[model samples]
Target: MAESHIDLGVVTAPSGVLVLGMASWIDHWPQLGGTLSERARASASIGGGHVHDWMCEMVAVRAAGDRPLTVRAGTAKSPLDGGPTIATLEIDLGIPWVRTAGNEPIILGDLPVDRCGMVLGDALALDSWTGDGHPSTDGLADVTYWGAHAEAAHRQFGGELIPGRGNQVRGWLDLPLDDAKSLGDALGDWTGDEQGRGVMVAVDEHNDFHSFNRASRTHPLLIGAIEVADCPVLGINWDSGDHSMRHRGERPFGQVYPVTLQPDRTGRTTMRWTIPPYAPGHDGPE
Candidate 1:
């Protein structure tokens, strides 16, 4: 018997969905050269913000209907990280995909969705880009959505079983960075000590979700790692500096593509999914 895989799913235009781990601001660490309050202030002004790849387990969706579904989630926060890691969150599905289950599962929804996947958790988007802060190569805040926060780019598409098991949640969102130069400047001396560090959000054709490193607009997806002990709050701690997924000498995951975002004079930015439509390309037996 072969493992089952499904199409991840997509979010059209401004609205989107994500089953992300806890996310947080990148510059919240002093070793990384910034403070939580400083990053918070910058996040309030600049468009460039970074967050930890994705850690905990969270679902974020943006759509019509304003309501919070009651749930008994984890209230305990990570000793290392400040935010609550395990919690029952009210997941308001803007687009309900399946029927509720019998037992109260950690995640609720129909079982074994043949062609579609289940959506859990509510949507949380924090829009605070004033576009008034000065743009720098380094020291910029990352975008935050829902209570989970934000992550950046990289792309993948396919329609086969993702080679893993169990239910997987996936979705997409857009973010603005400090261009390649500013990003490069922030990287400074890349001795793996303090190289280009950031967070990103991505979903593949298999509906496999990923919150990986946010590479520079100019840097290649080279393999690297950073010590992430000081910043324990999963929501604000952006860089885990963990590259264990890739083997030694292995290239960074996912195919790097150019994302064209249009920012009107008003400073509001918009990006549409192009090649390989934003939705998952699931080609499994239906």
Candidate 2:
């Protein structure tokens, strides 16, 4: 008797990989095995060349023979631009998993697998991520590594980034193009996944925050509103100086800053801050 393989389903995207949270439950799921796995081709807009494709396999050992297989694939329409492909698979496991794969100009979702790859080949082409130690196997540091590259790409192209609330309070903030780069740099390299990178870009870029909660991973703080003096306010927001979320004390609540771009010590661009006296624990001018 020959081994039987099921046509689980296929997901198509521009460039990013869509991992459907299989590793979490599949238990040592095959990086290249699985009855659900198969070969897939990406539909790029251009022609005159061979169509690129990738392996979409599910390890045979991990296949759940007792349960029925269900696969759903489709494109998530965006309010602004085209979105990435989303495919959900339910093969006995109760957990909900969706997969997507594609390149650039395609918006990524908040799935762990999606975040694992970050925006490596798409927006930011970092050689390091392509080499080895993928985030899925290497762990958190790898996630941060990919995140830094993705954030760098977003920095080059101005935008907003709103992450899922995930136990933290949520809100929104609008940033000016000029201020976006400076503030991103001053905040240091971003340290989240593709979802985090999505949250970092503003609405103008592609509104990647769609469906995901509008919040911050560290501490949820919104600027609410602000009024600056003679200096035109380039941007406004609750500057939570500490993104590490290490501070246990009552955070500097309502600490608003008038955003502006300025040259850092290295003569490179950075965000310059203008603190107000009324701000919590604000010590007057130096």
Candidate 3:
């Protein structure tokens, strides 16, 4: 086992939510034991590589707002290295936003009581695992550590975890190049009073939509949406196999409306958009 670390840079968002990207490059894939080996064997049997190990992308700490919130990632057992893969909201040290990656991205932190985030495109990358090898034990070991950390954080900052919403919709939007670009630009601009109604849309290399979510602050904010666009069409390809939820199955020419972030009388910001329905040939999720 080897130890390594990479500084993922800093965040400084006043909105109290941050989205960070995690990427990994394994120098060598290690042989393993326990459940990791079993999973690795299964993956290899079906032409999979490095599907059982987890990667830590960004660690968030609650400290002074003026203090730089430096994000970093490291491997405890394997010699791995990666950097923050995307640009996102600055961290408002007042709130904690940490994320870990396995096959899918998992967010951990506290969010404003009234704010919500959404996920679009494939919210979870069930088959795309980063890193070179399997862990020595069942993946639960990492979970145990994270669980304890969560408990400690809870005790320090009292809050109960609440379940957010999840929905699976099957359809795609075919926007003109300009509209597509505008949508893409709006997705990156996080400045505004809109405290809630943040949407994370995931797409493929071909700019085909695959996942969508109205997520909570507890989940990674919105950076993942941009990263997913660069990914291969994992939802429909063999890489995802039968595990991916077919969220975006139809491609229809759709109009893109301007995304508006308006502040209400109470000074709270909210994002508003009227997403068009699937084209005539396609239907939304039942």
- Candidate 2 residue-wise lDDT, 177-283, digit = tens: 34544554533444445554433322222121111112223322211111111110111112223211211121133222222223223433221222222222332
| Shift of residue 53 alpha carbon in model 3, Å | 26
RMSD of 3: 24.7
List model 3 lDDT by residue over 1-286, tens digit each.
Answer: 2335444344332222222222221111233332322343353244222232342211222233233343333323211122111112222233222322422222232111011112211112212333223331112111001131334333433223332221222112343445444444443342223453322332222211222221111232222222332321111111111111121321122211222223323433322222232233332233
Q: RMSD in Å for candidate 2, one decimal?
A: 24.5
lDDT of 2: 0.23
Cα deviation of 153, candidate 3, in Å: 52
- Please report the candidate that would top TM-score against the real structure: 1
User: Which scores higher on lDDT, 2 or 3?
Assistant: 3
Q: Candidates' TM-scores? A: 0.20, 0.18, 0.19
Model 1 RMSD vs true structure: 21.0
| Overall local distance difference test of candidate 3 | 0.25
lDDT by candidate, in order shown? 0.23, 0.23, 0.25
What tens-digit string does per-residue lDDT give for candidate 1 at 1-286?
Answer: 1112211222221223222222232221334554333433343233212222222112222223333222112233223334232212222233333222531122211111101111221122212111112242223333311111111211121112111111231222232343323333332222221444433222221101111222211112111111122110111111122111111111122311122223223432322111121122221212
TM-score of 1: 0.20
